[model samples]
Target chain A: MDFSQTAERISLKFSQKGQSVDTKKIEAKLRRLIEEFGVQPAEAERSVTNELAKEFNLPGIGTGGGGAGKPGERENRSIADVTPGEWVTIEGKVVAILSPVSPSIAQSGIIADTTGAIRFVVWAKANAPEMRQDAWYRIESAVIDEFKGVANLKIHSGTSVKPIVEDRALIPSILKVGELKPGIGSVRVKVVQEWETTHERMLQSGIVGDESGTVKFVIWKEPGKERLKVGAVYTIFYALVDEFNARLSLNLSTATYMQDEGDITVSGGDSNVRGAVVHIAPGSGLIKRCPVEGCNRALSRQNYCPVHEIQPGFVYDLRIKGWLDDGEKTYNILLQREVVESLTGINLNAAKELAENNPLGMDEVFLRMRDTILGRYIICRGREIDNRLLVRTCERVKMDTGEHTALLNRAGGAP
Target chain B: MSNGGTPAQGRKEGGFEREPARRVFAGELRECRHQFREGDDEKSPTFVLLPTGERSNRVFLVGTLTEKQRKGEQNIFYRGRVVDPTGTFFVMAGSYQPEAMQQLAKIETPAFVGVVGKPNLYQTPDGAYLVSVRVESVTIVDRETRDLWMLDTARATLDRIDAMAQGLTPDAARVKEHYPALDPAMFRKMVYEALAQIKI
Candidate 1:
């Protein structure tokens, strides 16, 4: 390709600053870099301009590379094909905008095309116009860099970002909960559990699932947004997926909801967690529940329920409210009477006898239960609801000597 | 379960998530020499920086309770030594942990036990820091349970060692700044030795 036009653009940039120009020398350098070394035309222009700027004692000038060529001159590459340390242009929709972690980063988020999605960052020095989330943009001359073993685009002052208005929709195809990564997608899920609104900003948050798996979802309070009821199925469009502690969840801040007919057979909420009973919280062991038909609330110290009036004749129950730690994560487990009785070998009648015989009264039963189960390694199978596991079955974990031996062999081989 | 009233009313009021308890071997646990708080508030959670570059607010361990002694005349307290496969862990339970103290007082010596508690760093007069577990809860366990704990702890330690070797996450990077002389191989060796104690 001819280098005169490109060289003239470089000379005009320096002349705009009232600096002396060397058009012939610039053209020769660009020709050598492109033809001999086979550097990308855009990269070659940047290198040559940077060289000229230093020769003229200019530090930051020519770094933008705006005078390189027209927008259509550079090749447009897919997100998946771009590699680190190369200058390439990519056209993708802004999938998600993550809050910037540093002052130097003006914007940082994931951008995706039909091929795949990749993280992108716009440096404060780039001075590029802010790209709205879910909008399409054609970013030119953006450098690729790697962080945490993942390649991402780095938009600096040399890059040019122009928003695009595509006639076709860039929305990704529907995905199952198990197939979700950190991006934007659509999914049809059943609202399995509804949790109390913990914050004013949260309209609702709960676990949603389908046959594939279950995932936590949060709906921020917004105008004209419909709340999802438990046991109802809905198809969510354009929901942003986020990950924390290696677990994925959905954020429906900028998403659309459609109530779907019928129900889904959910599968993923059931978990089998094995760990020590680190804590046997209070209100465990022998307790009384309000006898008023539908009101099963645990009675207070004086046999009074918050919602129901004083009930002198309350029904007795057994349960264990505790925390279990499986090394990596802790689970809040609620063990019902049957599971607690099987594990502790203390039935409801036996617990009532202990409470009546001891001067400590009901507190004695709690003490006895704590002595029987605290710090024990037990496996519990149950459905997780609002971060707490409602255990259906539980038993002490048996040591697998063969497993330990194999683990030892593998660990010994590790470098 | 009926929801007329929620379980753990006190925990509901706070509405904050609990910090997970990490499983670390006593050998590696003793090597932790740094402690930090995430914020300036007194209520901020304190974390013990593990040698493998992770932080633990609470730790779960199972070992053999070798001995025990009760101290403090006015306010009774209990101190015990628990021996795991790799090394010994000192546990203390005072009035603050009445349940643990009571449990410790009743348990006999040389019995298998499980403990979950926070790590407290005590600086000696000579300027060296010593680590011990402030007992949260203690219970009797079987040899099989202790062996299982050893296996789980070994796996967790190896995972941390690998993460530190990669040095990818911010936790690993921050750990490098504090423990500059830290070596992943040493922790790997510790894991191997700990696992070797559990015989099939």
Candidate 2:
């Protein structure tokens, strides 16, 4: 057959097997195989068709295992050894059970054996037995299939799933950093870093760890309230692991909490930052705050704080939302009332007077503050919360004329 | 149970760690309208998922300051138009945005500038969305900086395109699911053509 006829036949076979293959990809792969191997056209066609059939687990194709076993009752294969189009009886524990949400699909989740883990799928029409999580089940006549390059088991009506009690000790616990998945996970580690706070909200973020290593963590309470002191050992429960720029950060919500296991020094993690003030964001000017003690909430347009709710005694406050670029990474730096006042030398009283004088005068004050701070290199000491630097203290980096000239040159300009 | 490993910093619940700004053309930014929150919680970070599959909260762009105007009779804010080879970006800095507004006020039009800011989306009366930048910081840079930003942004855009090709990111998969007809090669060509505009 010609190439187009061969492609047509392969597409037809895949459709009959209830699988959708990228016809273009198959045609390209077939062309590459023919060109590279220099095999006869008819032989290449048969090989491509057979391979695609096996990948989709269609019946009547050879198991391709090359093992001497019975036609239907084959010896158990390891999780990794289970190939597409092969049927085998395997004993393994279901690691996780995922509820299939689509109307067309049924149940699916991850199942692992001694060798490795693979996803298992049972179609809605298959009417297969339920696979309980963390329980060992001996699955007979389960066909292996490939989905997106990963080998998976397809439990059809022909498959039999029998529960077998196994020792729970064989299951893994307390995921290491390497074993961390993007779902509920627990880690036991010393508090390597204590609470870092952002002034915009009473939020805390820091690092937690054990020898398998540490990961970033964020809790939505003040450090004092969370009692997350540095160098303390705690078992952090129910952390939602999230990937930021390929690095994992744990989010501790109401469902998540930590148990203190006393003091233990965790070496090597600190967040002392210094960088040039590259940008100052809006909300960096005169602002009103919630009157309630310890509630430094920025009032909404309705003049209400979520916690305090339209109190008559709201006070004026100062804050700055700025960016600091330290050559490598840019940090969102938030300076609270005191830091803003000290850095710009604009007290709250002066800010109020400026606002009272003219409607647009407060804009001018913020403009002046921006002029004073932007582009200047400064050292900042604080903890990071919510991916922003919560500055406790800061000072400008004094640049000599020579240093100034060097900076200007690097910026591609002359002084 | 605590497992030990290297210590990494944590990010806040509602806030995301600020992503590095991506240099992009006006056309690409204008075309991006889909915005979604990453998590269901109140603190979940919202991101503007681009057609090229990049999820960004902040973008770094360098362009020519083509025009400037004062908007809002009651509020009195500054709006500047910055353009690259593809299109223009409207950067708005109000009284609240003191630094960006002052920089826009002092700088002359038709001069090169670098702006780092958050992407702001507004829906108009005609049911179409308008894209603009809430300027965080705007600086009057030279032509060289403009060229460097273009190259960097093009490289970043290409990275996203490559990711789509490899099917490595969920954003890429979502792009395919949402915009089935989008030709990724078109974005790749757009980046290369954008890079070609630079003399060096």
Candidate 3:
């Protein structure tokens, strides 16, 4: 079959799903195409077959050089064909996309077409661009093959792809605004709040706003932490639907796919809100039991992830995610590790020794940031952390109840 | 003996439609040989489905077949499987005669028949807790009996659909009129409604 036909077959299989399609079925179709495409390399035959299966180091289907299945299979064979290695063109609509995960980069996406959902590896790394999530596209001359028995079709430099449409148009879905809780991939939101620092495990919290609504988005300890700014809003290209506390929330886990290079230039007065510390418990001011940043394992604590097992010195720091009551509602914030260490001049090794010597030795640390963090008004900046609107703490702050009244006024989009 | 040459029929108001030849169900019956007390004079019937004729279709052979003893009082019982489209259900007989036992022994796996008996439904810890009906008066009949039953079932199914389709249907209210105990006749009408919808 020709490339346009191959593209159409795969796209159709994709739209049938009420939601996303599975990855394995797509790969199989690619394998069928690669194996079935090349008949007798007569100039015309080669061109037609090549449209179905692009050149790849990956094993191509062995049709014994007789040729990919006759042109008749085009009308009959679904993208699910068991044909081992043939280049057969397939196509369809992009009804769904996979939440990109990686050995490769952040936000690796998968697209689907008619014949079936073919798993495609995007060598074309980019973020949520002008395209719509459900937009239809035609990928030309992409190599189709099986990886570890799974059929995978990939688009790289050698592959050609074009977003398809009619009536002076391009792209799939019209980007909407609302509180995005993850799966709703492309959205526009604003900075609602930010927490200082929580777990020694870096985590940023914020609320994002959109036209339809606003919801919390969280950006976790992604690769590039320096990329965020407070009070700035921009388009969030990709986010994930995840579950936490039995409820759904959006997460921006892969740093690469947290694509909006644009930031909201919006800002507000830098004030500190202070509240009385409700409570403090064990591990409050404890020394850095975890290994330093370069250090893989926790120096003494078990709360760290296992992937960091063998590294150099670690960046030992303390973090507390606590509630502060300014006489009304209680809010949350994360005090950074460095701030915790700076606030409490004790180094990791010394703190550990002190903690071991006296169980409550770390009590002083929480106390310093307590009142300042509690009743003090924290300077607020908006940033999307983990696909959320976070009030990044600029400085401890508090505004007069009357001024705070005015603050609530702007929340509704009033000037 | 019209087609496959077997005798079985579903229950209908009218009696068997065919001449009573050497009907598979014709024979002398037997009574329970054992008895025991069952909770303040109330006891449960113990009839195993398809028992190979309780030691071969005879409850009282001049000579004893085996030294096995049963325990139940007040009712003469027999047990067998009744195959239906919904699946086979184990049936019991509280007052059937030895002829019923003889018929059961002669009947094959897909036998069709009309039976009568009070049902006692209970639950097992596992199993979907499905109710098993115990059938009595097991008999073998001719093709005419089977056809009559199918026709009756088809008619009954139609009545139910009509009643259900009614704007002023008194289903539950009419049910209470016969009351306390469900008049199976009414519910059986529902079963017929279910059957008639199936394509022949």
Candidate 4:
């Protein structure tokens, strides 16, 4: 609403360098950029400052103490306002400190304000003082740069860091399991399952779920971190989201969690797998099940159930126990009667009829079913439990000739 | 009946982990002349280095069974020529693979068949190496299955070619060293040609 305050701030930056400034002219430019042209206040300020620097023949305007401006005179810009290639001051809490991959990067982590959060890197050459985690710092003259379309700050030699006191806490917004990508976020989920710890470095690993869906989570062995109890709800903060085998999982190595009072009603989400039915297990096709109400276990050739003993009046069912190989990994898939009947066009009644007429009995149905489905490429969708996909639906994968043709054409091959 | 009851685990015989069967076209399968084992031990898995920089221990292929011949009176080996769009893959089913041998013996000629097996390279006295599949399982498939396999193999071949073109990883370097005159364009052409056979 008022341009004189913004104009005075800009004039003070130049005045600190002993340059003669025009407050009226700076106010007019800010009014034109913000009111007439509809530019964001911070961006407009930067554009007008760059223009004034060029006009006054002062290229070193915002380069901290090295420049004409004093070290702490520059106003701190909102983290959301900073754009790439501009030098601005930002005051935000250090929410996360990630392990730097390269030696040239002395520290790399996430900084957050109430507006938004962004990645920041302190270069080794900057020789800046270490900023404590969870503490607010006013970073002056930090250069903004972009990597992979996301904006981040690059603290170099010219940047000055100072600890500041702030009352309000800046907490990142919580994200649902379905909305997660490969990044950092907070989530509230109940521990659905705790799987066996596969490695010595793994403190705990399990499936966590919320109202939206479930996701696998792993917490590496870290000091002062507690294990998560199954079926207990918790709000996890600053968890690193990682992707493996195209599936997203939360890595809680550097995260903190708090037990929540309420519970989450999780949805048994479905996943899809596409591959060839490489192998069919022996207990497939027409099988005799125990007639007992709660016991439908497959009966042996002698019409005996393992738990319920011998059962003469056995119910017939058609199913396919097989492995689906998607080139990289193998999924143990259990295709129930409905899915098997839909895929092979052999219903339970037809399987029973085939077994009754043949001298080989149930083996005939197994052989026929294997011939119908094995080596065929299919896509199955269902919920995965204990590393097995309980296939709800199965369909043969039709070749999309047009897509392949386009792909080949793009690869510079004759199509 | 108890709902959500766990199904029986269909563990393969001997309980050994099965190798992932890589999909490769008949043309690419025929060109896999370099075969090497991972270790010197007899039990070490052997892999055939594909020209597109993939080392495949087992391959799943679907093609038309063009011809079949029953050889050796005592051993009774069944050798079949399976033809896809690009080329023919020779498959052999011996006594050790009785089920595959039986299936191959009974299958009619010119029928679409799917074969999952390991590629074996044998050197003749004249020093010419011939690649053939030691059939693990053979089943009668339909035209749609064969067409789908072609598309899948095309995608897989293109992925390997793309990986090889991107950079020389250890596997890609091994492929380059084995096939000194390897040209990714040739595999790309093969994939295109394989896909062209299938109608929309």
Candidate 5:
């Protein structure tokens, strides 16, 4: 599990329980818990999670086995065994106390057992006891409903909420490659390779592998931070997965944390190809950028940059993304501003002039430019970056103008 | 899928990929009956199948601008009709399409023009769909450019046919699925017919 993501989720859980806890402070505490106190990362996570819940008087989440109940009073159930339309007595720790879905709702969030986690909702009008984060709960007479295919518990006037204590740890299950999805997940992997940054916000990217297989990962970290050393094993916490053509790549953010778990070797390589330009993706024309120093972020919707905040000083830029096909296979290629301007003969200033003269005309000009080279052949050099060729060098293969002219003349022309 | 098989993540919202503007005939554009969605994401691409069975998000064609008109009382919009050898293609430009709209406003009718644009498939409540080109670019080109476009489009269409025969492209699979009646031979005939229309 990406620890940073776990920390973030934990902090969010505490905040939703109406606790005043600083996220940065939590992150710092988590780091110290693992490094100084020598607590296992998962155990450290539980401690911080439990400690905050105690201070805020929040329900225990991820704490195992709770609530007082009599035998045969209600059908006992585990989280993973839940199905639609089942009314059963379930016991689990409150992993997260989510914000009420609406103002009229009292409390709702995820409750987890060793089997799995499911969402629970206690409607406000029920006037049920409030649940706290990380607190164990044994609720009786809760009904199950399938919402969008996921089973969740519904607590109402007939339901009873009880806070009970248990002493088992809530550890994020180590996931495999096939188990990865487009959401938060944690994985243990060997750093097979690491690449230098080529794109913004992507501090470092390369390959990571485990027993199942390998996947690409891009670490989003502050510049100059210590990167995960190649040839080492690390437990990544709170990582986000993004899929491309069925392939997955992991994204690391600030809320995530990593722990070095010694060293292991892994292997992989890159492939290269060349082809003709087939398509030009949209956003191929004039665009604006944030003008802050070292922060040329794309400005959209109110002209804002997340990092530098809102700075109206904008700059013009150009880019083109398209495919290159050499008959057999096709490769996605990216042409940055310089290459685009060089190929299209349309510079930022020229595009700006066109935009000024005819704002919507820019799209037409863009398509016209795409036509000029779409069928032409070209040679581009770059390795694959998420199934796309990050073209480091590009040169157009000049077309045989003589033969094309002859063919056009013979095809049909006005007398 | 509408965008052939372009990956979903790479073409996120706000990003654009120029679909290989298939060289579709005006008649085929009008006769196209099915639309395929590549991805279900909010920004996923939607493509229409020409009568010849090739999928197109964008199209490149050369034609004669037969007429131009500005419509709308509160908002001025530019709409034109371009006639190819086989049939007529309706092209529309509005505030959102300022560039094409302005160009249409300036162009004289009966002039040879080249257009590259997204295929706009409009479906009525009655289940009838109208196919048109959302103008991306409109340029007044000479007859030579028209002939060149014809030959290029013919070659590209032939390539698509060959790819389909070999079962090499994802588009070929979609064509086979949605347009089972279409064959390379039929598309080949259309390409030849289009080329024959170009008088030297």
Candidate 6:
């Protein structure tokens, strides 16, 4: 069959020098065989699958044994005699990336290649240190991890690794996108738009796209802050998945993390996953009225006792409503007087002056001079309760550079 | 009549006028001394008290009473304000009243009168300030009040939510899809479920 069109589509989703092998075609052929025979679908499909395996010189069905090759059972290769927990190394091009949110899927993940995104076990965070998407690396004995019915090699200390960074470069022929998942090392992505904060400066989520797919990325740098140049592309690495908000999500946490790199870029992954961009609205933060430390009670009128009624009293507290993000979600954060004082250089007196002059208050002044803040990206790892969602923050590494360089840094990141 | 202007003098209860009211013991010893002045009368407007200082989480004091210096009356309330690091609270007092005098006389040297009246604030002509709380009968209380307040405060501290990790849930393992599979609110809802069990 002329699979040129199918191959081309894979190229758009995967990468340039590489593309995913068309699993759909294989499945389709297997289904046809099943329909033609009166036997069980699994039985008919396996028989036909075995014939194709021989033609492609693929490992024969149930070759490695001790473990039975039953229906829905792992294929026991006869020659390589490996156990379920045993680690083995497979040097292959990364077929497909789980698209930042696949680990929690089906209890593990599936990285497709000329083979298909297979279930791979990455038992710990440190395992798959070098096996990024679209890159060629030697994956040692990653258990058979499954996701969405697909199989992949799991990364673990028990497993092995070595980087052949440019497996994409080694391939002599043009590759389609579908075949590029295993090859995902780093890919250039454009910043489409970022989600603004309501309570204060923080990011909810961001959308970026490439020729392959478009996906959403959440931020907590500052709710209403974090300016992004539209269409600015950067590289992304090692972002996997977890379950979030009832459905699955591309989690950029401990297991899966994303970075934006300005220089080189990679491609997309998976047939069903579409990288879509989102334009979320900005959020709001509460403004506070400040009081003078020594003379504040006069305004309160009722809080003053007999003594202050004679001499003059001054002083008051300031507080406001802010926002925090729980992943790509938003939350309300209460900015008390102490927190405000620490965050802003202004003291109680200066803030009062700012408040007196502007009806919006001191925070508004900070917002107006926002070039110094607001848009700055921050690392938010520590989690706190914000509104209802947990607002998380960690130390972020920020660099003074052009939009181009900033994105490049993010692109070259690891989990 | 605690807020009704008077020095620390007299008690109308069964203790009845208890002794005519002495000099130091005649008036209530005020904790927030910032409100007192020499030439003030028995009345001031209103005032506010933020839950600040040592008693931060427990007290929110706002009262209406006479600042000794208001109405240009000469009174003896040496101090007027209490600076609870959280914020300052003002106290207004003068000489004495029949009821207040009763308590002052019975209590030993300068003692605290757990205020029963609200707060009163008065703005002076020269931009000075006078703040105080009307006095009520003093009661001696202890620890339980403090604990409940602390509990209320701890309850207010908020926490954030992240999505579920692999094997995070004790049960349920299903093949996850990235796109056609991404459900944004599901994790948030899961967090709510977890939070439901927690309370102060």
TM-score of each: 0.58, 0.44, 0.29, 0.55, 0.50, 0.24
lDDT, model 1, position B126: 98
Q: Which parts of model 4 have CA positions greater than 4 angstroms off?
A: A1-268, A385-387, A411-415, B1-17, B39-42, B168-170
The two-chain DockQ for each candidate, comma-separated, is 0.31, 0.06, 0.01, 0.20, 0.16, 0.01
lDDT of 4 by residue, B1-200 (tens): 01111111222333345567888887777777788886576887788887778777888999989999999988899999998888899999999999899989999998999898999888789987788999988899988888777767777777766666666334765776789976778778777766666677
In model 3, the runs with Cα more than 4 Å from the true position are A1-92, A95-183, A188-248, A251-262, A266-272, A281-283, A286-306, A310-312, A337-415, B1-200
Relative to the true interface, what fraction of contacts does candidate 5 keep?
0.01
Best by TM-score: 1
Quote the RMSD, in angstroms, for model 6: 27.5
Best by lDDT: 1
Better of 1 and 6 by DockQ: 1
TM-score of chain B of each: 0.89, 0.86, 0.40, 0.88, 0.81, 0.30
Local error of candidate 2 at A302, Å?
4.4
- Could you give candidate 6's fraction of true interface contacts? 0.00
For model 4, give the TM-score of chain B: 0.88
Better of 5 and 6 by lDDT: 5
For model 6, the local distance difference test gives 0.32
| Cα lDDT of model 6 by residue, A196-308, tens digit | 33322233345555555444454434222233455465444333333333222232221222345463232332111100001111221223211433222222224432223
Selected candidate, larger DockQ, 2 vs 6: 2
Per-prediction RMSD in angstroms?
Answer: 13.4, 15.8, 28.0, 16.4, 15.3, 27.5
- Candidate 6 Cα outliers beyond 4 Å, as residue runs: A1-60, A65-89, A93-143, A147-151, A155-188, A195-205, A210-214, A218-231, A235-238, A241-354, A358-415, B1-200
If ranked by TM-score, best first, what sequence of candidates would result?
1, 4, 5, 2, 3, 6
lDDT of 3 by residue, B1-200 (tens): 11111112211223222111111111111111222222252432232111001111111001101111222476545556544332334554444445444544455544445443323335458733333333323444333333333332223223333333342233324333323343324333334343443333
Chain B in candidate 6 has what TM-score? Answer: 0.30
